[model samples]
Target: MKGHYRKRGANTWAIVVELPADPVTGKRRQKWTSIKGTEKDAQVALRRQLHDLDTGKLSHAEKLTVKRYLEQWLDSKARSSISPRTHARYREICEKHISPAIGKIRLDKLRPLDVQRLVDSLPDKGLSRRTVLHVFRVFHNALERAVRLQLLSVNPASAVEPSKPDQADIAVVDSAGAAKLMDEVVGTRLEVPVALALGAGLRRSEILGLRWGDVDFDDGRATIRQTCQLVKVEEPSAATAKKKTPRFELRFLTTKTHRSRRSVTLPPSVVGLLRRSKASQSERRLLLGAGWQDNDLVVERGDGKPVRPDTLTKQFHKVSDRLGLGVTFHGLRHSHASLLLKGGVSMKAISERLGHVSASFTADVYTHLGRGIEEQAAEAFDRVVKHER
Candidate 1:
């Protein structure tokens, strides 16, 4: 109910606080906390503890280690609130990065320096700056939940400054380059999928997850319902008792965001390409008969199985390398937006077509392409002025 501090060393103090008596036994209770700072800081800490007691938010310190707490968090809070892929990623970050660094430290005793050291040592461990930032964020989120649950008085990660990654260059293709890519993929397995990527602005996952039912040849639109992802799962090998081998399995998950589950109009050329692909698949299905798997994927192998997402990327890389396009498969999506912008499409329309969360986000990603549009606008304005005069 009340608290006070006494100097234990040169700048260290012990804060002792009185607690409500035990219910049945009527025994007195007290909690002690150590502060390693000036007397003023000790006073502030005591006040905070007392306030927490008054508000029924103070909890007894436990001997829980960071590793144990993170495991519990991932199993309970994270599993329920986040997607399975995200939960797995968070657990991987904890195990591969944070746990090895400071997992043995007591949760309540974790300090800002400990967290900073973990972050600072990551680049030396061959982790990218982006990866380092991601690890910090995952650890910080777990600690934040601990604070909300009254498990700790503060989150140590808040005091640490994470390294910022440099801005990544966005690769885009011009009209001529897009034409070259299209021509290179003609009569190849990537033909229809590449057309969908460039013409419909579909993400790679969306393209692979597409089904025949989702496309409307008559309407020239395709509904994005799900995305395909390759997830790593643990499989126990028969030869080993306690050893687990990680294997990847393809999963069809709901679209990344609500806006991502949208319908995009297909360009006429893309529609024609899809029609030809459909007829080709139908012929293969009949030829294989019962031998076909028949998953009904829009872009699949000849045996009617889903194409591996990585294979799609590698194949695209091969074509791009040969053509010297210098653009990635994902860059096809960027090229779609760039072409639309240069063709005088409205930002809102383009955003919706690409299933972006907002037009502002679309603009931010395509800001590099704005210069050409600006020049075109200035020329139009000049023409209008001369005609009016």
Candidate 2:
């Protein structure tokens, strides 16, 4: 019920608290927690411990290892809160990066230096700065939950500074280059997807998740409401003796952001292409009769099953390489934005078409493509001034 602090050593204090009697032993119980700061800090620690005891929020035991604690944190707190893709990514980082380095260390005994060392060693392990930063964030978030639970006084990972990721160069092809790539993919299954990417600026997942119901051929627009992605599945261990399933499971999820679910007006050419593609699919469905999957997906295999995003990327890469375009599938999206910028379209319009969160974000991403427009603006200003004078 009451707690007090006593100096254990120079700058060290121990907080001792009395608890209710043990039911089995019929004897009083006590809890002692050591603090390593000033007198004020020791008093604060005592108050926190007494409050935890009063509220029954005290941690079970200090014997929990970092690995075990992280696992528990993910299952109990993270799994339901985060997106499935993010939860899986966090688990992968913890298992592959953090577990091997400091998993055996007790959670209460983890130090800032220990976390820093783990972060510092990531570069030597061939991880990029971005990946290292992601790993640190995941570990830091897990440790933060521990602090909130009163399992540790502070998050050790917070004291560690991971390397910052470098700004990646945005690669995009010009209209002519995009046309050349499209020419190469013409008459192929990738034609419609390439058209959608270059014309509507759809992400690969959005393109794959496109359904017939989402397209408005009459209005020349497409609504982006969902995205398809392949989530990696953890294989069962031998002890579980479960039957093996596919390594990855395909799932349809909400768009990357609420703003990402906006509608994009398709180009006339893209609309025409999609119309033809839809007619062909209808004919194939009738030919296959009851054997058809009838998923109504816009981009799918010969059957109605959705095409994997990876498969689309690979095919795009192969065609780009064959044409010497050197443009990624995402490059088509960049090209779409670049062409719109070059055509003097407003950033707000382009941003809305691309389903970007904001016009400023669209402008920032396409700033490099705006240099010519800046020059044109300067020339036009000079001409108007000279004519008026």
- Candidate 2 residues 123-165, lDDT tens each? 9999999899989988898888777766676677877888777
lDDT of 1 at 274: 86
Backbone clashes in model 1, listed as residue pairs: none
User: Model 2: which residue pairs collide?
Assistant: none
TM-score of each: 0.79, 0.76
Each prediction's Cα RMSD? Answer: 6.6, 6.4
Tens-digit lDDT string for candidate 1 (257-337): 788999999989988888988998999999999989978899998888888899999999999999988999999999999
lDDT of each: 0.87, 0.84
Q: Backbone collision count in every prediction?
A: 0, 0
